[model samples]
Target: MAGSTKTKAKKPTVKKPSANKAAEASHNGAAHAFAPEPGDFRRYFDSGHTHESLGITPETLLDMYRNMLLQRRFEERAAQMYGRQKIAGFLHLYIGQEAVSVGSVWGTRPDDPIITAYRDHGLALARGMSPNAGMAELYGKIDGCSRGKGGSMHFFDVDKSFYGGHGIVGGQIPVGVGMAFAMKYKETGGCCLTYFGDGAINQGAFHEAANLASLYKLPVLLIVENNEYAMGTAVHRASAEPDLYKQAYAYDMKGAIVDGMDLFEVYHAMQELADEAREGKPALVEVRTYRYRGHSMSDPQKYRTKEELEAKKDEDPILRVKKYLLDNELATIEKLDDLDESVKAEVMAAVEFAENSPVPEIETMYEDIYTQSDYPFLV
Candidate 1:
């Protein structure tokens, strides 16, 4: 007893209650349940109205028509080239979704940065990127905007501020945010128009970018070009909350849904949203548009029926704009026909230019690979 100290009795350890169970218990007896109100999502403008009321002149309408027609014709030719094996790699045609890009681009300033997913020829053309350059990029020619390196999905025009045709789903989200952040940091009086699809809205990148954009009040317009499908998967099947614009509510930002099939509606909505974005208010816009073709040239398109595709054709943006032009007496049928002929000719010339252009040299593969010069080891 004198040599050895008596051991103290060990106390039994007690496990603490689970925090999740405690939280549930605290709410168990509450009379009210937590329920969030539905977001106030509505079309901000009427699609049926004439552009005159919105201060869009006849000339501007004609330009919009021409740009949309140019994009359509260019894509048609590109599809033909793909079929002929003249153009290689993935060809994501922007057949029916032309209005979203054309109208949205027209709504923003010329210097404002614009970015979109791989279905991007329309956006590049709408932003005034030359068809020759775009087609050359598809042909992997030296005259391409990316020096014949980017192919169909990576069209980038630094001079026009067209950021890129990002190939990865939701890959452009944070890049767009970074561009907006730069604009804010530089006080450039410019904003960014970032476009993705309904499929991308489910990506974590979009949510993180949306949260950051809201937190920093970044000048960016996050557009969800909801064509109802992400590749073969339908939006309804993929998203638990199919209403994409409402997702912005979680970030405490403004959101709206528009008839992306109507050029006038898209133009007006984009105009207002672009103005808001330039004023440092980031917003989410869901453009309910549809694509006429398969996800890519290789797709068999077993997901939807021919009947569904035919039904959506009735709301074709190009045809709708053409009808509006005729109905409003903005342009006669003859003039429109002439304009269509001109666009076709232009597209054909672009194809010829691409055919004649030289392919990028093998050495070019090493160029434009890295931006940092300090990494001399790369050489």
Candidate 2:
């Protein structure tokens, strides 16, 4: 048979699908595979809980309000700047999620390190980065933090222990763990507040970091700023376990969900979790928050409905704090109005400062690249 020039059967060639088609298939699979729970995620702190029981003074409350308001106004101005083409590149506004950053920051000690994903202006402001420097950074000015190299997504203040605003999704998870490991190694009594969006919870980096943190009992608080979406994709669509805090169960780490819209609740939850983290017990805290703005300046935002956004507006964290101040008779309307006006003026001044600041020099681009400078090429 072999010598008779027999026709061999040909094996079928399997053509791999296009990248777009493969992505579409993957998206469809994810969309269908996700199954969210019917009820809310289990939480440590309830909304509408009074901080008076915890002896949080009215002055502290006012400070919290001011911090949140400052962030809100700063972002509002940043958005305006983006509209005017003054602020270039990506601008991810942290409009409605102010309480999450402000409250969590206020709960932590001054020396505790903070690292978050982009959409980080609020966290930087909350961590005491100067509004002028932050705005200038957005403007790419020489006076800006990171010498204007970082822009909107990479705000860093080494003195304040504010690590960075990482642009890559979930990239800061392991970095934060490393920071926490350093804290534990040095016995600094300072924990790392590692923040990422609910979208990042699906990332393998998050799981690996969480596992390592739990395994080593590193002093790290993994905070998921569950703003419901990762860019355009909603939690229900992207995550198999949309209840993000429950993912901590896999590592047997303590976990809690908090009302991120309520500043008091966020502060309390962060305080508890951060304390535990500092005591060498890693924890996961999912702050259920929302963003009023689109993912970035360029986003068209077709993923979610207008009605859904409107519904979330009623729970605006800034508004909630304002209501709390008024309802408790802690501050008169005039005082609150004055505070708002002051914040607006401060934000405007920051914008002016950024406008006046000089741009970075081309020669300095190679500076701050590395700590050790004895390169063979330089020699």
RMSD of each: 10.0, 10.7
State the lDDT of candidate 1 residue by residue for 293-321, as single tens digits: 99999889999999999999998999999
Flag regions of model 2 displaced more than 4 Å. 1-42, 45-48, 371-379
lDDT of each: 0.90, 0.88
Clash number for each model = 0, 0
Predicted candidate 2 versus true structure: per-residue lDDT over 289-353, tens digit per residue: 99999999888999989999999999999998899899999999999999999999999999999
Model 1 scores a C-alpha lDDT of 0.90
lDDT measured at residue 282 in model 1 versus the true structure, 0 to 100: 89
* lDDT value, candidate 2, whole model: 0.88
Residue 133 of model 2 has an lDDT of 92
